[model samples]
Target: MNILNIDLYSILIAYIGIALILAKIMGSLFEKYRLPAVLGEILTGVFLGSSFISIFSPSLSWFYKDPEFHYPLEHIGHIGILLLLFISGLETDVRTLKKTGKVATISTVMGVITPFILGYIAGILMGYSNQTSMVLGALLTATSIGVTARTMMDLGVLSSDVGTASLSASVMDDFLGIIAIILAIGASSIISLAIVGVNMLLLIVLELMVGMLVIKYIMRAMEKIKTTKAILGMSFGLMLLFAAFSQMTVQAAIEGAFFAGIIIGTTAESKIINDDVKAIAYGFFIPMFFVYIGSLINLQVFTNMKAIILAVVIVIIAIVGKVIGRAVGAKMGGFNWKQSLQMGIGSIPRMEVALVSIMIAIKGGAVKGELADIFLAATMIFVTVTTLITPPLLKWSFKDEIQQNGG
Candidate 1:
């Protein structure tokens, strides 16, 4: 292979190499500063993507501009998102969720409904169509359980009443967010809405029957295989199979991937493949997904007064809605004012699921053209800002607890 003889395959290999290296370094730096590594990975893309490279190093910008580079990278990013959702499903603690009690249930409901309504109203007031507003609402309905749980663990409260409720509620929040996106996709017409409803019902039935029954045995059978990594291979294959089936029926591949995870997660073999799956996902695919999200962001949007206004308004609505809604629910669920506030702050951050919802909405044509560009950029800002602010605010909310524990 001549070093100078470059082709599309070569370009892709080179791009992946550079992206992985940069993603790892930036991710490490972010983790060192106690920030989300995903945010840093996104920033890496921004630095090398059109936002910065086009301005700082015009020659290199061609890599992003060339379709040869963009499309393949995009497909890889899709795989990353699928794996991410699968991991989310795998980590879902069904037993804990059932035991989350009335408090978690009430908080989850209000947390989802409040942000969704506020986001929709904000979108409508800003002159967006009903479908776009619905998608916007859907975007606001998820909380980043990963970020919240990590913060809680660090604060020594992951086992506290408030922490348990928040984590369980956040898990439900993801499920609702996915549902919201599906509803948004079908909201364009009455016939579409009816079809969507039917599809949802079908999905539920299938998930109950196939996911619970068939997949269990399949995983158990795979466990008998003596081949190296065979269990892992079988698990990955099941994820893809379910993803395809889900997409074919419900028009959402991630939905299938998620359900597949929940099924396999219940199997005894789940423990065996969990670490390896995460290694493949985080080490390569998931970082690329977030970076691809970053690359899609048009930094030029920030310069537009209209875009700036929209982003700011949405961010405010996101923070306020979650706090108010979850707080009230927490209070109603038997917490004091201070504890309710803590719950609210804990539920504020929205990351993977939020970003995935908006991206899917855009790709599904629920949002398009200038609106898509604007919303995408606004969402990136929203994710970054929420992820940044939640940790410090969550700590502040837990001050009394920390002080009492002698920390």
Candidate 2:
């Protein structure tokens, strides 16, 4: 285990150890300043990542240079994201979502449509090809439920009316964003659209009917085992299985983890496993996921004038589109101005799905080499800016409520 000649396993072990320790330290520091711990976790990655190291300490860049190192870290981060979604699902109150369902649905529709149209038009105005413009629009349509859910939970508002609606709406946003991706990639045939629609319907049926019944009984049997470790292990395994199934069918594994959590939330075991699940998720996986996201951002993108301008335009349109669209929809659905604004802010952050859409566009040959690089750079900036801004804005938007409740 020579440090200089470290193998893959050794490198991975060292990386995880460093990541967890730094993440915990930064997360706590951010919390002390009343900022979201997620922001600190992400910043830790930025500081340790190639973006910083390549400029300040080129010798240290070798740690992330190997493809072997990159791929394993990415998969581990993916698991963190799935676990975050699973915990979000488990905490989701079905009754609250049901009460806010109409608002959520309406807001999600408007939220998706507005940003998509704006992004497409912005791309065209920026002189990108039609295909690239469609991809841009598709990117704007994403709402990162992981960021939203984590921030909401940190604020202790995850079960509130606005929180429930925002969470539900974010889920629908991701699904619709998938459809946008299909269109962007020139797969908008009737057959493709039908398949997506069917998948959505299937997810609904599975969550509400078949999946619920099956998981309920399984938990009941597991409960009979009478051991906390057994229950935790069973729950974690089911979450992974559900995530895999969901990825195979709907192309979104987090959705599967989410639906699984919702099902498990209804069981008596939910209470027993809640704290343990949080300990596992927050202690390791979730922070790593945020850090991985930060690492993906290459600050060098800002060096290109064209890319910087494009990112600025895209960021403005992305924020304005979501805020206006969701606010209008929320108002139409009977919310006050403040709550509508809160929903708008809640839906602003875009992460994994946006990046995926752009990659699909580039790899599918819709965007050419130089343009693809530009688009990717602009997208990374967009994701980073949107993510960094959301937590603070969302907390401020709910300020009056927090004060009223003495939170």
Query: Candidates' lDDT values, in order?
Result: 0.85, 0.79
**TM-score for all predictions?**
0.93, 0.75
Task: State the lDDT of candidate 1 residue by residue for 1-407, as single tens digits.
Answer: 77698777777798788888999899999989878888889888877678777777777676677888898888888899899889988999888767777778888889888998999899889988888888888898888876778888999988999998887787788888888787777676546767787887788678858788787778778878989999999899989998888878877888888888888899887898999999999999999988888888888877887778888988998999999999999899999889889899999898888888877887789999888888888888898899889888989989888999899
Candidate 2 per-residue C-alpha lDDT over 248-280 given as tens digits, one digit per residue, 9 for 90 to 100: 676556667877888899887788789999999
Residue runs of model 1 more than 4 Å from their true location after superposition: 1-3, 153-156, 189-195, 223-227
Per-candidate clashes come to: 0, 0
Model 2 spans > 4 angstroms off: 1-8, 101-105, 124-135, 138-191, 226-228, 334-380, 383-407
- When summed lDDT is taken over every stretch of 10 residues in candidate 1, the lowest stretch is 184-193
Scored by lDDT, the top model is 1
Return the TM-score for candidate 2, rounded to 2 decimals. 0.75
